[model samples]
Target chain A: MTDITIDHVTKNFAIDGRSVTAIDDISLKFPSGSFSALIGPSGCGKSTLLRLVADILAPSAGKITIGGTPPDEARRRHEIGFVFQDASLLPWRSVMDNIALPLEIAGGPIGDGPRPETLIRLVGLSGFENAKPAQLSGGMQQRVSIARALVLRPKILLLDEPFGALDEITRQRMNMELLRIWQETGTTAILVTHTIGEAVFMADQVHVLAAHPGRLVTTIDVDLPRPRALAMLQTPAFNHLENAVRAALFGDELKAEPEPAHG
Target chain B: MVGPVVFVVVLLALWKLAVTAFAVPPYIMPPPEAAWTAFLKEADKIGYALFFTLRNAAAGLLVAFVLAIVLAAIFVSSRKVTHAVLPIVIGLRTAPVLAIAPILIMIFGRGIGTAIAVVVIVSFFPIMVNAMKGFSSTRKNALELMHVLGAGWFKTFIKVRLPFALPFIFAGLRSAATSAILSAMLAEWLSGAPGLGTLILDASSYRKTGLLWAAVIVSMIMAYTIYWLTTAVEKRLTAWRN
Candidate 1:
């Protein structure tokens, strides 16, 4: 497990000869072994921040370090794993091969981590080892991707709306699956999501971001009990945290519009 | 198999009926029975010609297959190379191979090698174009996944791009298989060689209507067989797609 520190990082993209800042001078620290979620409206740079930490994009200013090492170095050392919105498994490869991809890329003797077969079972895909990605349903495909991401046993895992495409029931099931996997692995996880409930339920801390030169508006620490059960969602405490995150987003939206309520 | 055989038999029966019903002149259109008789009488000669032409077609397709793969690789490696070479290929592909055949015969003289060359020229482009499209059509996220895995360019091409391109390549091969025989026969016709194309020409010149019809039918059967064979190969290789 490793801590990720973002020190005043900013990202700007040039379009039509005009500069647009996606993430604007945001700073935060994700201590080792913490589960943090960045949630806000679309275009609030949640995905961009996760991408920066994954070393997929470079910061225009400031720095991001993983366990006191640069993001690039951590990525090169295979300490960072990422899951995109889509499962993105190669359709030709079977479930086992897809999960084994990271190990194949690493190209060495089996490291001291969970094996690919073990991960297939971990993701609840034990019987379909030889089945191609096309044969599996969307949720099953996402599980394969999750197993693939964890195959390298990365120190930190980053997810960008990994379950956004699933139905609500499947999404909740995957959420529980992810929580169990996280607990078992003890790996630091950073998720970029648009769902307030998901962030509150899944994260140790939630960072609410605001759009239009995206910046972090606030960080809410989830004071929920550890080894959270599904029943916790029905509790008053979970509802309160969910309401607080929703209110922050609603307030940001209202502040941008500058309109009064008629009713 | 039974369906094609039945359809062909019915078509042949209709042709026989037409010839007998209309009392058509043998010179204009020989009766189906006359062609069948000719095929039986010259069975040894016809079989040799069939083997020779089929060999030419197979050899030409093999050469074209290799050339297409190499050129497709080059084309995929750099846009500059594709830009420089593709216009000429498109030009060659669009212009009739028949027009180029006479000039090639004039330059290289009448030989089996010249015929093979013409077949190669006629059949290589489709494979190149299709294979190029296939190799380039690798999913963007697949490439990004490779990048995240720290996979090198060669590994990405072999493991991802190549497999993705197989179905397309097979599609190209099916088309090329049909064209291979046609180009070989055309080459033989221009070069005055000993294959079925030359047999057709000789029969026409000698006014042997039965022999001419028989040779044409033989050529049709060869084309059909090659098409079927290619389809079978494609099915076996890409069973996963089903």
Candidate 2:
């Protein structure tokens, strides 16, 4: 449970003898014990920014201080956990083994411990201990990945479209499940998503990034209410926030179009 | 039973028809009934020979399995060595096993050991190549999951990488099993105590074409048995794939 402060984070990728800027001069701060959603149109560097915070990719310029230390330092000591859009659970590993992966990597005594049993229950994967990834459904497999990321008990969890591959019904159920898990665990989550409704439903703050030399366009705080149910999505307040996020994205798309031939 | 049984029946019928149509002498080509009668009369000898070849085939397959896995592990652990040595391994696979059998016989003599060695050499390449390809085919997402979870290189290899490679390795084994039986018989033709190869040679020398046809049938059964055994193992190990 800690804050992640990004100070002028910029990312450049080397491609075909040219450097392409993915994220440019973006400064954002995610406070402690809060669920923040990074919402943006595709290719707006939302994933790139999340990867930088997860320490998977280093920024070409600028610094990110995670929990008062560099993400590089944070990740190595296993202070941050990350999940990709793909469930990414090892096909060969059973659910228990997948969940126990962090402990195995951390190289500690793996025995009857209080935390391990509690974690299995927390994810609602009680009877699926021996089930392999291939044996489970898409939703169940994603749950294993989530359990694995949280196994290390990191303060910050970074997710890059973790439910993008699941069906709409599954995704909605997952959002509810995720909220339940977060409420119980109190771990700060930074979810990078494209769904405006999802952003409004999940986040305390939704940070929107606009493309074409990608940078943050706006940040909107959702003071809607706590324990936000799926039913809240149809409310006027949710509609208002969704419209705001939609307008911000629409404005960016409008600006990105090639201008009509001028004299 | 479905495809191969139909294939064997068609093949035997064609051979019988050719023998009758050409008016081929009994010593040259025996009819299906005569071949069947000869096969029953000499069942004990054929059975013994079949057992001998099977023993050699099983031994060879085991040897090839061990060697292929070790080589694959070595190649995977060190990329530079794999890049350096892979072409030569592919070249070995290209060399026909029959072409090399006599040369191997000259070196090791026409004994069971030579027969086993020939089968091992013949079968090793496919297993090694399949294992390499299977391990490398591990999904990138699966790997990232392991990495983020803190699984080390060896742990990742055994738990994640190895199980994923099982289907491919078994596929190679199923393919190699056929070659394994063929190579063992080829080696037995050159040397060995008393296998189907010896029966074939004795029948050919005595002008007993019917007995030779029977020996051929026994050997075919031996080869298919290996194939089916491997296929069964494949089915059990990779029930998840289906």
The number of the candidate with the highest lDDT is 1
Q: How well does model 2 score by local distance difference test?
A: 0.83
| DockQ per candidate, 2 decimals | 0.39, 0.28
**What is the per-residue lDDT of model 2 for residues A154-240, given as tens digits with 9 covering 90 to 100?**
778888899988899999999998888877667779999999989999999999998867899999999888898988989999999
Per prediction, the TM-score for chain B is 0.92, 0.87
Residue A25 alpha-carbon offset, candidate 1, angstroms: 3.5
The model with the greatest DockQ is 1
Off by over 4 Å in 2: A1-10, A16-18, A25-28, A58-80, A90-141, A166-170, A231-263, B1-18, B33-44, B70-79, B96-113, B190-194
| Collision pairs in model 2 | none
In model 1 chain B, the worst 10-residue window by lDDT is: B144-153
Candidate 2 falls in which docking quality class? Answer: acceptable
Listed for each candidate, the true contacts retained, as a fraction, are: 0.30, 0.33
Which candidate leads in TM-score?
A: 1
Write down the lDDT that model 1 would get. 0.88
Candidate 2 structure, TM-score to reference: 0.82
